[model samples]
Target: MIPSVLPTYNRADLTFVKGEGVWMTEADGRRFLDLGAGIAVNVLGHANPTLVSALTEQAQALWHVSNLYNIPQQQTLADALVAQSFADTVFFTNSGTEACELAVKMARKYWFDKGHPEKVDILGFEGSFHGRSSAGIAAAGGEKLTKGFGPLLPGFSHLTWGDIAAVNDAITDTTAAVIVEPVQGEGGIRPMEDDDLRELRHICEEAGVLLILDEVQCGVGRTGKLFAHEWAGITPDIMMVAKGIGGGFPLGAVLATQDAASGMTAGTHGSTYGGNPLACAVGNAVMNTVATPEFLSDVMRKSGLFRQKLEGLVASHPDVFEEVRGTGLMLGLKCKALNMDVVNAGYDAQVVTVPAADNVVRLLPPLNITDDEITQAVERLEQAAIQVAAQKD
Candidate 1:
């Protein structure tokens, strides 16, 4: 029988009762090594003590307050985000999609406030996923995302991924912003090269177009940096961050430079549930943990270890894995076999993995996952590969 809930997700058969670190316990008492990390949302892992404590403390004190009122937690989180990155101001939201929406509006508004109301076109790359919203779908230009959604919020131009010439041609006087993911997570963990990023930055700067980076999936310590774009030594004028920023709680933020945010005056944008005390409290905890130099260095060291192990796994199971791609913990295993076949095999091996476009299986473990857990995850992946190869044979 079909469940009462909306049939949006291709719901997996298993039900998880609880989770801790990189492990989740199924309803049937089976324990699974969780490499997917809830699609990279659980940055600090499930039920992290620090995160739990922060949430609990905030809950005990206050949960919700009107945006009209000043919230210290929200201000504190915003300040931390500003301090850690290129942004001078931060706008909180409930999810990455909201952040993306605000980013688009803010960019267009920036130009509009400057008397260039026609500069509303936003250019997005070919294989990027920017969440499921009117602006996001139109910006992504993916058939699967925009098929039935006719007359998608217009003014979005699609460009070939990593093509500097196309980008140059696309940036006309009407182009208000260029939005791209530093690492295309749902498009199969494709990391944009540093040189290409620099070129894009230069082009945007020369063209006077704002660069909006959707770091929703790759930011907040997922890439062993505070944000993935930091690896390329370039900063987007407007950046959308989510996923790990909340440490499994529902929180997102759009960050921008002071001049870039000039359009967003009082009453320009607001969110009811955004920047609530509970969410901000958790965000503070996550930022405190992830933004620390020692913590980020550990993430880099762990990423190196994970990369070496995954390369070895690919070597041992050439029939299953094509190659390993992605930066830091945001890794993907491009598959020689069907991506879903490997994912299903991972189920049998008691490991969770996420399938993406381009025949890739994503391995997004928590930043705080232990070395022992990393070794265990690799072993489980090896087992899944073996099982998949046997099925093909």
Candidate 2:
């Protein structure tokens, strides 16, 4: 039976009726450990008690109120986010893409307010994914995403990551901002060099441009920190955060310094459901639960274990895997064969993974995934690799 809605994603046959912690239960009662974590949005795991209670409580009281009026839960979450990061002001949205759009607009408006509306070109790097919105696609600079989109959104330019000369050359008087993902997610879990990120900061500073980081996928403790750019040891003038922020709820934000956000004082931007009490309530819960010294240390320990285990698996099945790379639990397998083949084979074997631009297999298990679950996932993955390796050329 064909579905009514057009499907944008590759097909996956199995559907789970319910999920808890790191496992999902299928209609047939078969349970599979969910390593994908809904592409890392379920950081705290599905049906997280805290998140459930927060959303349930809020839903019963007030699910939504127009942004036209004050929202206390929104304010509380804003205060928590600002306190945890280098931001002084925050604007809420319903998803990561919305946050990305807002960040780019805010940066350009910043320069526009300074009487440089001519500084409209936004420099983004190749393979970086901000989101699917028109502005995000324009700012990402990936040919695959922009090819069919007619009359590409003007003022967004592309530069190669780590190409100092190329990046510097791309910046001009018309440049309003430079957006980069400290850790590229859909681009195959690539982590940008810290030095290069620092150089980008200096480049933006010298060019008098704002540094806008698209942390939509890699932010909110996905990379074992509140934000991936924290590893780069510098902050962006404007930053976008969404995934993992609401503990699987739809919540996104553009956080900026007071100076960078001044242009957005009032009527500049708005979202009716962006800062709903329900989403903000859960955002507050997620922040309080996940942002902690012990939680981060656990992430470090678990990440080390994953790397060691996956590397061992790769060595054992050298024909199937090339290498395992990425930060923390956001690891990827650079495949020796087609990535989709491995992903499909894993699915057939009751395991799941995500495919990325560089033919990489990504595993974004919950941050609190236990060592036992890790061992099981690796075991299934090894079998899946063996099944793929045995295939004839």
- Every model's TM-score: 0.99, 0.97
Highest lDDT model number = 1
Give lDDT: candidate 1, residue 121.
95
- Candidate lDDT scores, in order, read 0.94, 0.87
Candidate 1 displacement at residue 142 in angstroms: 0.4
Give the per-residue lDDT of model 2 (tens digit) for 211-276. Answer: 998888888887888788888899999999888888789998999999889788678888989989
lDDT of 2 at 215: 85
lDDT of 1 by residue, 178-280 (tens): 9999999999999999899999999999999999999999999989889999988999999999888998899999999998999999988999999899999
